[model samples]
Each structure stands twice: as structure tokens, then as C-alpha cells.
Target: MFDTWSVRELANADHPPSVPLNPMGALPCIARLEDETGSSWWVAATANRWTTTHVLVLWRPDPRNHRQERLVWLRKADVRPWLHKEQATRT
Candidate 1:
């Protein structure tokens, strides 16, 4: 299942209760997020547990840098489900 909402909607909505970190002190969840720009991202909760404002995302690697994995931070509110018409039809 996916949480389908826009950044603006998430900002105006109430947040869910804080989720507990795993024993290793990480938020153990992965989500497929879509931004307002229509870009899709696969993100994992970062090791930083001091705040709930941002998440770490694996960036699309360039062909020349295939051996490297690029990570970046994105606002939590900007993360939303990647919905498509085809997916809806199948469901």
C-alpha cells in the first residue's frame, strides 16, 4: 500500500504519531515517493533520528558513475505515492 498525497496536502494535514526506530536506531521503512515535479524516487529513512523533517533518497546514477550510489535529502512533505492510470486499472 502507498500513501497518496501531495506535498501541499501533507503540509496542511496532521502528522501521524512518531514511529519508533529499530534497535540499530534507524527508521526501517522504504517508500516510493513522487514529487510535485512528477519525478519518482525510492527513499529510505536516514540514520539521523534527531528530526522527522527529511529523508535520504538514492539518486538516479549517471552512466559514468554507475559504481557510485548518490544519496540526497528531501523534505518529508514532498514524498507521496507514485500513482499511474495503469496501476489504478489493475487494482
Candidate 2:
């Protein structure tokens, strides 16, 4: 996604980011999904915006500096079928 990526480090004097300049460039991202069969599927997708099914974020604060670190993002989905399958397993 356009917003999911950033420069890992300052690669140039101008500090240009590694993100592609193309508006339709594929997002530098990946996803891992596990089904009821205990098999996992890795999904590859392109994006120009952040998708709930493509990412998530968690944040923690730095107690020493009293400042919070950047949010962490994860890729997951809220598929109804998956929910039902999980519920079935519990029962």
C-alpha cells in the first residue's frame, strides 16, 4: 500500500524514500493466512491505500522518554467463514 511502506534508511543526501514514485506501484507487502486445515496461505497483494485485511498496527510507549513508538501493523482479515470455523472448533 502507498502508506504501508517507508524508507528503511536515508539512502541519499536528499533522503529520498525507496517507495516507488508510480501511483499504481505494487505495495511492498505480504500476508499470511491459515485455514482450518492447519495449512497456511501467503497472499500477495498490491495497494494504494491501507486495507484492514492487509494490515494492523500496535503501539507501545518508551517509558524512559515518555514517548510512544510508532504503531505496529499486522495483516489479517475478519472473514465470516473463518469466524464460523473457529467457533465450530471451540464447540
Candidate 3:
């Protein structure tokens, strides 16, 4: 369900409005995000209530050190549909 306009404007969106947390049966979607330092990350959405400027993500475990990964909320503007880059690779 990838939209070329960046998953329904998540990448172009301004700050998201604050919402309440819905922890149960969260519908996650794959997204590519760039952090504050401009590091790209592949993450899954978990919740949206963490912060207005952020969206909660289900962080994956680190295989390098076998460390347990914790959930994180990323800047909304940094998130783009995972397959948004698809067209670029095809050419």
C-alpha cells in the first residue's frame, strides 16, 4: 500500500496533531525514516500518540550485540513509505 506521494504525505506533512495512545492491535506499516543526524532507517509504525512531532516505531533488535531494542518515536516528516524509492531503483 505504498503511495508515490510518500505514503499519504507523511514525508511532506507538517507536525502531526497530538493523539491518544492506542497500544492494542496497532496497525503497523513499513516506512523509511531519516533521523536528526540524517541517518536512514527502516522502521515499522506502532503507535502515534508518543508525540505530536513523532510517530512510535517498533524498533528491531540489534543483531550485532544481541541487545534488546526499545520502541522509538521518529519525526513524522522523516518517515516515507518503504517502497517510495521503488521507482528510482527500477530505472
Measured against the true structure, the TM-scores of the candidates, in listed sequence, are 0.30, 0.24, 0.38
What lDDT would each prediction earn against the true structure? 0.42, 0.31, 0.47
User: Model 2: per-residue lDDT, tens digit, 1-91?
Assistant: 1222232321111211243333443343334433334444333332333343433322222223425333223333411121235556853
Q: What is the C-alpha RMSD of each candidate to the true structure, in Å?
A: 10.8, 14.1, 10.8
Of 1 and 2, the candidate ahead on TM-score is 1
lDDT of 2: 0.31
Residue-level lDDT of model 3, residues 17-53, one tens digit each, is: 6554575445445546543344455555444344546
Over 4 Å off in model 2, which ranges?
Answer: 1-26, 47-91
Clashes of 1: 0
On residues 1-91, what C-alpha lDDT tens digit does candidate 1 reach at each position? 3333233322222233553353334343444545456655554422323237655444323324546543444456544444456755763
lDDT of 1 at 83: 49
lDDT of 1 at 25: 44
Model 1 TM-score relative to the real fold: 0.30
Report the number of the highest-lDDT candidate: 3
Per-model clash counts, in order, read 0, 4, 0
lDDT of 3: 0.47
Give the distance in Å from residue 86's predicted Cα in candidate 2 to where it truly belongs: 41
